[model samples]
Target: MSTSAPPDAPPALRARHLRKQFPGVVANEDVSLTLRAGTVHAIVGENGAGKSTLMKLLYGMHRPDSGEIHLDGEPVRFTSPREAIAAGLGMVHQHFMLADNLSVLENVVLGAEPGRAGVLDLPAATRRVEELCANLGVRVHPHAETGGLSVADRQRVEIVKALYRGARILILDEPTAVLVPQEVERLFVSLDRLRTRGLSILFISHKLDEVLAVADDVTVIRRGVTVADSLQANEVSSRELAHLMIGAELVRTERPAHPADQTARRVALGLEEVSLRLSDGRQALDAVCLDVGEGEVVGIAGVEGNGQTELIECAAGLRRPDHGTLTLFGRNITGTTLRRRRADGVALVPEDRHRQALLLEAPVWENRMLGRQSAPPNSRRGWLTRRAARRDTEHLMRDYDVRARDADVAAASLSGGNQQKLVIGRELAAEPKVLLAAHPTRGVDIAAQQQIWRRIEEAAAAGAGVLLVSADLDELLSRSDRLLVMLRGRIVAQVDPRRTSTEELGVAMSGAGESAR
Candidate 1:
């Protein structure tokens, strides 16, 4: 399929010699980019390559150190996000910005609510949202509470909110990081429709295949500089794109599992007859069973909200399963507390890094010391040793290659990739026997993703049984020795990762395959 955007369109947005600098990092240095109307322009690069920083500058979240921004034929400068929005620019952040307590309509129209005489015009706002949804082919219930909706639904709400604000150019950051194959297709369809309506989109993604599939043009950035711009997607292959982004060959080495090596290794983690019921009485998990042996990497592949989160929570001791038997290292831990599980050597790289893994407002040192500050040399007699913590934080920062101004900087201030590295570093430093990694590499750049995969393999080689839950089929299949397909809270099939096709996995993930127990 041809990946290049239509060639004859005029430029809708343009940036010239953009520059941004933090304390120790020149985020963007003489970067230039142009977006054509009715096209999907993709920005591709490694974490800390200044892709996000450039986007932030364009969106008015951060003012450029030196740059010229032009909308259509007029030069412009935005001091804040509100000014950018007023100028027909909208940005859907990598992390969601919706209030869970609010209804979908309320979330879409937040801060710009329709009202008269201090009374909210709920009906009017809802009708407008309905019309917008229909026009964009965005499926969402306006009256539904945001908390009750799935990740994909929330993403749709974000899109609707941007369009509601009269945005002509939309920026989507890592839009497909959490979506399943089917949901990704639906999203692409919506983007295509929007393009047809003359909307320009700046799509940022780490997945090369997705970029090739939807992007009209591809831009590659390296070390805060634009290396390649407006490359026709069809003119280059995914492998070539990976090479361009990393400035080197990204070799995918595969190792065949030796069948004779599979012995009666001690069961490190076990789940039997696990069942969970939602608050609305819907069964999220239904008698699912799985086992992980020492030194084994068991991969769980499924679409988002298909009981993967519930199962992981049950195993992590975060949520009590209604009916299940969970064992860790031969000890029953079904009803155990999360702290107890942690003390028992259970480590987790949570799905939502910002919300569940790291404390955004806390300094990098504090986030690094979390869950392990009370152990060994860092704590004595219930008092945390600040010196020891700082030293350890420095070690992790250096070891993990986490780019930050300083250890004292707030976790939220770091880029998404750097935050992920910090989370992985902290969790892996504990050296637990059993590790639960959920979406461990989401939104990470190619180099970071490679590093994370290597770390997972290293942990498995060192005898730590790993359970990997991910939406990226290639990541799960390529790294894991065995793959278990989850559908509607049950294991539908088990297959050798090396042999399964993306098509077959998609079938299993969507519950469209022949019945197999």
Candidate 2:
């Protein structure tokens, strides 16, 4: 029923009436889209709107209940990811899946290695990786340790890894979520090169302008159904696309005015000459000095790995600074443990929620009891009262608008945006005086972003000092009272977010402009 393909030439990939259902949920229903050869086709939708489900069906992560997938005009059924890969398909997840300790070449040839009699063919694999990287215009050090590369380079490596596996059609998920503006442009260039070389790309992202900029055609899906497809990217505005995404016009949340009386504010959290070193002996925080005032939102803008993680960890007592003084409400707490810090009204929504925040296999109620396990309403006399925890979890779910089957459901069952909301709800429930929020709304939909921003604003309006770190320049500029840019582990520049633009802030973040040094 899918036209199958144009009679003369075949599309790269096509899905028709795809329906996938999970326990207690219909993830995808009546979904259809086509990826033409040698084009960047974008798929845009809200979180839990069937985009991921459709991608999984295409990539063979999950089989569709009732659908037809035609590859290059030939009907195909992929039983697993291996089959998909064998048929010229590859998927790069939002999180990069490379071991830090391994070399780029090693990670690329890991599972699908060419060998003779159980011995690896290192020379042939290296040649193939280099050839693929060159063809795709990917600039990466194949022999270098994957950990030492920048986020952008690592992403390119992922792309090369996919190509090395003989992928002609690539699926990129939230590829720009972690990149700064400059790096984003670089990635766009690489995608263009790939497209020109006849590789199809199915781009998925919540960033509308980006989709409009790079995609040749756009598809919109909503609530397990496809409402629009094959719309020319140059013909439609982002606002119109957003309306299609959520089935209505998007409403911007009203933000509280930035506190004007800066001189009258009290120092809620202070870091004085904070210095920390990674286990690899890199200077993670080079004499960084910062302060957050009560009732103020101070935003930090930085490329990831430039001390943002270490600074937040130091504040939350997850890492010990080699030399520094951390003060909470004018009291030094450099030696405080994480539990004691949580008990004293300090909380964090970590950057990588899966690795640093949640216990994926655990029930929702237990995850809600994570950081604030010792706080009131969920704990009593050195023990967690399960009933109290479940009751609060239920309330938090409603309050934060987290979508899940039930409080007893596993946290892993929810979508990424819902998982993020769950983490934010749990941290904010404690009513902490000092809040360390990193990438608070990194990869959520517009509606969920509004809710999360509203909650953060509410917390700050109630006199909590918010130190927000995010790669999203717009979020930082719109939410922060003052913005500080980090470069090579140091606070190199401070800009007035109300006056400065994202481009200017991006220049500052990369240490290329506006320091006035």
Candidate 3:
């Protein structure tokens, strides 16, 4: 399945014998690859399989212990990211870094200003940004504040920033991990356009369906080495890729068949006329209404930034709705503090794990005690109990399969999957009557995702009402008894997962289908 170019034309980029080692592990070893010109190349691997390390080495974020990189058939050494950019290499990292208060135009041209004099040139930069946006078919406001833009728009701005620097080869890391099906389609279209214009792309993603749909060729990595370097994208399937990543077939848990009666079950959560206006003066939520019954899973599926985050925050008591009444188990909890809501048997697995869920600087045991300081095991009579906390942390580590050296280690030392495991484990340990889960399995490996889903399913089976918010449509369909679609801050449709398809969900998510109630 190898498709290397003929001997006459050189590759757009090439790397040989890359080796990088950390204190306790060999992150990468003897990895070599090639990116043919005017083609989309993909690197696929599970989390902690050295995908990010390899990309960092290529982008000059870290120098390899041993390796060589060549651009246009000539050897080149990039000492810094700036050097890589000057050599026509640009990378959009998985985590976005944008100044919230700054205008989109300012953030785009922050480091790469155009004018020669010391005085800044706003008009020139705006025009250049507008032109780039048009060429890429990305719709974004140049004058709007960065904080007001959606996650998809911010990602487009990041790409426009890279293109403004004259990048001929672009690297995108886990680009579609946060996007819904519709937004993923738009991104694929943009990538295809870039390839048509003769630009080389190196895409990094674990989503195999996207890899097959968007890439011309694929490379699979496992255990810090390239397992298959020349697999043609069209010849591979997601099942095959999963097997390659884990060296075994993926196992799926069987969901229980007992359908809970929506009317007979006790109501665990009730929201009525929930509307929210964001700080930027935009309508984030539009009179949304939903109800979750005990022992039921109600899933909210939509494109990112379609008020999913806002909805979760309002439910978690982090944000106050401009208009709505929130009740838990027939008790009105509107305008209540998060702690009071938590004490009332409410728990949240937030969307942004790093920013919202756990404290990175704390030990694993302390993180396990987070959000539950008012309860027992971690605390007794308003006093923190170290021994009990440590004991429970060890139990969670073993049960949740958090791969850490010890519970005494910092939470920051763990991988993304492990961090997510800790968060889910801690949240579920609270034994809340209602769970608000937002992208709980995002950025995790396939195995980790399975485990998380199993935990959520168990919680729901035990009569815990779950509000599952996810960009993954398959996850929603598999776990949700009922599915609700959100578009432009409004709940546009509701359907049973057993009778719906991803195609129908995609249309409803994009607001192009008939509204179902």
Candidate 4:
């Protein structure tokens, strides 16, 4: 099945000599690429390397200061995203843009909704969505509430949303960041199906293996400049691509040596027979007992929505379980408030940074004081001080290598990777007894991921227990001393990270080897 376009065919999308500048920074300069029809063209770069800015310019979210954009070989200019969509371009942002309260059908037909003489045509939209999902082999019920869907299903809904709008080209940003190994395979299959139908995809990802796996073309950007363009993906190795992206030898994050054995170490976090029932009458968590000893890293692997979120929330004191005993250092803290947990040396890096960890409109300094407003440095003698907050913000930025003009700038202005770094630094700076991190390095590039891993391991080596939940099997295999598999609200397996293979772990996650413990 040859998906490549003929040599004589015009590119589905092309941008040449693209240049964009913002105050105090040049976001993208000299960026250019041609996305051939029926092929996946990948764009790779380090954080702040201008890939996002370039995509923005292409999607018409931000108009280029100077450049030429051609859609189907005709020069055009798009003033906004609406214009780009009208011109057959669609973009799926890293953070999904969907109303959780709505059904999948409602979310998909929201913008270009069908109408029969001023009346919403719900049936027509549902049929169309159903057809699109079937064609793409995406199994999502159109009428299902979006809030309850798995992460993979939500992503499928977003993709189908574009197709419903008649998009010929799609720009996917980190599409596989939160996907398991199996889910990643399914997504690639869907992308292949898209390619067969002559749709073009501009893939942006930090995972080099994914880019090499599915992309037909590769483009590299460094410091807002296009370092390389139109490199054939099949001819390039992951090592070669890594070098091109960062212009340095790629040193993959090396996991710190795992502490020898955990029998003697005291428990930092302990959960005994925990169970939770959601308001929807769904059993979100079965009686799950767990323990993380001081200086140990415990990794949880499961498909999204298989109770990982609930587990983390319960551990963080955001959710009160129906029946459970949560102990910190052998002391019951099951009913403790989130603030109490923090003060008791439990630090949490929540999964959703935007909703849980940060105020987008606030400056970096204010965000640094978010969870610890009453703690020392942030406050003294029960009074918060802006001066100390600002000082700490400066320190975190410097230490974490958060790229920003200054701490006074709004957090919304930093790149996603930088925002993630900021949040991790804010949490880790407390040096808590336990670190609860969920997908902490979701959207970051290679170098930033290394730094984050190093920090988390340093905390563990300092005798702080860490409970890590991630979709990245490699991270779990490398960083964790023990890995737990979750399925249908219960832990079904616990395997030694050093002994089990990722494929076996993926099977355990799916309930095949449910009792692999």
Which number leads on lDDT?
4
Off by over 4 Å in 3: 1-7, 121-124, 253-261, 374-376, 380-388, 513-517
Worst 10 residues of 4 by lDDT: 253-262
lDDT of 1 by residue, 1-517 (tens): 2233456645789998899998767889978888987789999999888998999899898999888999975899999999999999999988889999999998999888889887889889989999999977977889899988888889999999999999889999999998878889989999998888888999999999999999989999988888889898879888988888889999875434746567778889999999999887878899999999888889999878788988888899889999989999788999899999998888999999877988999999999988777886578899998888888898899999998888898998788999999999888888888999999999998789988877777788888889999988888888787789888888888988888887788888878752865
Stretches of candidate 1 exceeding 4 Å from the true structure: 1-10, 114-124, 255-261, 380-382
Query: How many Å off is the CA of 323 in candidate 2?
Result: 1.3
Q: Which ten residues in a row have the lowest lDDT in candidate 2?
A: 1-10
Question: Model 4 over residues 341-398: C-alpha lDDT tens digits?
Answer: 9989999999999999999999999988887788778898989888888988998999
lDDT of each: 0.88, 0.89, 0.86, 0.91
Better of 1 and 4 by lDDT: 4
In model 4, where do residues sit more than 4 Å from their true spots? 1-5, 121-123, 256-260, 380-384
Give the alpha carbon lDDT tens digit for every residue of 1-517 in model 3: 2333456788899988899987666878878888988889999877677888888898888899998999999998877999999999988887887888998899899999888776668799989999989878898999899987878888888999999898989999888988878788989988888888778899988677888999988888887888888688888888998888888899766555554545689989999999999887879999999999998889999888789999999999999999989999989898999998988889999998889998999999999889887677988998988998899899999999987767887888777778999999998988889999998888887877888888888888888999999988888888888889988899988987887888888888877843564
Clashing pairs in 2: none
Tens-digit lDDT string for candidate 2 (1-517): 1122344678899999999988888999899998898889999998889888898899998999998999998999999999999999999999999999999999999998999988899899989998988876776767999988988888889999999889989999999999999889989998988887788899999999999999999999998898998899999999999899888888876555664668888899999999998887899999989999998899999888888988899999999899989999899999989989988898799999999989999999999988667766778998878998898899999998888878998988888999999999988888889899999988898888988988888889888999999999999999998889888889988888878998988888877853542
For candidate 2, report its TM-score. Answer: 0.96
Pick by TM-score: 2 or 3, better one: 2
Q: Against the hidden reference, what TM-scores do the models get?
A: 0.93, 0.96, 0.91, 0.96
